[model samples]
Target: MFRGTGFGTYYYDVRQVEACDTSFVAQNLSPLECSSQNALSLNHVNSNYVVAMNHSQLKLDMSKYCGKRVIVTVNGEQSNLPLFIGDGCQRCAGGSASSDVWNAVAAPGLDFSYSVLEELSGGAACADGHIQIAWEIVDDTIYNFSDGVNFETAPAEASEERTTSSAALVMSTSLSAASFLHTPVNDDPVQNAVAVLARQGYGDATEASSNNALPTDGLLASLAEPR
Candidate 1:
């Protein structure tokens, strides 16, 4: 079980991860390279509360939650949501959720997925493009990934009222992931430069050079030139 108060945002229409695409960023590259690999699709998943968290923050063995259900609580409202890992180092406090979960707590605004801002503000505007939320993964189970791929739908009446009480190992931590428009930029120039290189499919900068030196001025100058 993972629990903490952090930030939350809603996302939709992100059915697949793409090469070098900012949306649905993942720490692992294997998922992005394989066409069949994907985050839980809203249409395919049985529940409406699927979410993706920052891999770095969660730091759990992927095998534990890859295809399992976790009980997620927000604002005293609880739901069993499918969990996945999103971008690692870019996000710190907030992770992304499906739009259905967002609609339950706040008003609808933009048709496209970004970050939850005014939609979650309850008519009040928020400058951060995010809403502070208390959320927790109260329970999780070991599940077969193959079986989970073909999800089952629960009865409509049970959707909102569903609850889980299974005993699970309790682990506490905050979750986070970046949104397309509102990803917080790092202040350190070297970190920023490394991030730019990583975004361009240059492989993980943290593991790139044997000596781990800051990117040279020549390399930074080259990045400024038009591709």
Candidate 2:
């Protein structure tokens, strides 16, 4: 417990294995400030996280966890906010290593108390939430492999309409072959071939045959190969 010279002002702290809790008292103190006279400014608590309150609003600091993902709850309400390190809250002195919690109280305006909980173990562990730093750090692998092909060939027939004549074909068949050797090869030709074939012999039939005989396979085969 810390006492101030004024009538009713003091600071108290409770310690836990994973957390530190602090409380403050303010009596006959107007515009009470923890970090400074301005309530907008964040206090420099020893810990990575800090919470301060003024007559009008509450201020918090969790910036120490920047680059290190974390989540916080205030008065039992989870923030559910992006706990992006360095971005949210204010950076305190000595980082999160200093004090897990710190508090100060001021009054003569109103009486209130605040409770905060910070869980470092549950949030994303890295700057980019995409990768789990724990898994990556533990593995310490020097190399990674992906199943795909890489093209290393010069354009032999760079045709825009035909894939077989494009650089991708040369890479897939030759340079990229080494990577996809185990994968089954694609047997079907490119779409350009099908389009070219569709144009052949189209609209060539006489009106009588076109109207009477359907263009079904049977009719087409009968016309081409007479029985």
Candidate 3:
């Protein structure tokens, strides 16, 4: 156990082993980022794949084709991702795509070509979230790829924001009025320091008799930005 700041012992790991069917096995897991094995190809620019959690990993060894270019895709949507290598690899050939599992935390699918030495990296996403990358090899250049796609954990509410001209006018009038108050304070330091707030949106500022209190002049005009 690692002794430190009130935290208990922490450990992490991943498994990648190659089997006879041209696939790698991945057992035990730690949060690790993934990258493509095929480093140089054209198709890799716009394709994706999937890798299962704790199953096997995709292969990277491409000794079979040392001087050719190939394209690959990687797609995934799983958490608790792993990095595969050698025997634990899900695909030893480094060329294939995978389908996703229903209701799975995160699954990765990759399309890459094996043309040379493969660098198996981990924790590509940094957090426990899953991120997928693809590899391609053409001619001699090695290409790594993935598109910037984000899937929200929760589905978006299909709602619209609506406000009429009268509503806006009323709000404006209310702000510079004799009596005005805002909702809860925001995180901005400037708002926190404002001890008093008052606006004179309505009422005239003309000098009526000295007996009557002229509507207070607006010191706090348009205090908050309209959402």
Candidate 4:
């Protein structure tokens, strides 16, 4: 779910990846909100890329979003490329925003003619590189947005921004499965570190799911593969 101060919310969903000849196939993308009006279904040729957009007119200097998952379409093509969302308003920070959030990712056969940036800014200087998206836990209620999506109040400049413990900004990008598995373990230093970071961002410290927590399967997928 995407949120803004006065604007209403929108939902988005992504398709899953399927095994292809050499790599994975990315199928059609879906917007969660699209279903509200019409049961929007996507048509694609070859599954290749997933997409994301920023709809907030507010400035956005988002965190790195490589290797993350965006929307979810069960039993469909899925891509692991992470997407970085920004302000939809070009006049705003990075020229990314909410209008972008409505349109779905570029699927093989889908037509993503409508763009939030294009709608708001009349056009956009499209960013280069495959986007990496972060996925929210299936059922966990993590709110940090102005509507309590991430928090009651919005972050200064970044959508996911908030004060961070020194360690959070410096924690290793790489982590052992042990880090996630150790959640129920004693109040060890690493666990404590994760806890503080979660809270600093207005997340629940005692919640089993951490908003800061991301899917490690992608990382592990790379590591688990034969060398």
Best lDDT among the predictions, by candidate number: 1
Q: lDDT tens string, model 1, 1-227?
A: 55555555544324433322344333222231111345434434432234445444444454443434444344566533344322222244233433323332332211112322233444333243445555544334433344444233434335544432121211111112233223435775556776766665666766745575445546765765666
> What stretches of model 2 exceed 4 Å from their correct place?
1-65, 87-91, 94-205, 210-227
Would you list the clashing residue pairs of candidate 1? Answer: 94-176
lDDT of all predictions: 0.40, 0.26, 0.27, 0.28
TM-score of 3: 0.19
Q: Candidate 1: which stretches are off by over 4 Å? A: 14-48, 57-59, 68-90, 93-128, 141-144, 149-227
90 in model 2: Cα distance from truth in Å?
A: 7.7
Deviation of model 1 at 175, angstroms: 59
Candidates sorted on lDDT, descending: 1, 4, 3, 2
lDDT of candidate model 2 versus the reference: 0.26
In candidate 3, what are the lDDT values of residues 14-68, reduced to their tens digit? Answer: 1222322222222222222233342322222221122211123222332322222
Task: Report the Cα lDDT for residue 83, model 4.
Answer: 25
Which candidate leads the pack in TM-score? 1
Per-residue accuracy of model 2 over 102-209 as CA lDDT, tens digit each? 222222111111222223224322221111111001111111112111111123224444765576678767855544433333433322223233444334333336
Question: Comparing 1 and 2 by lDDT, which wins?
Answer: 1
Per-model TM against the reference: 0.35, 0.19, 0.19, 0.16
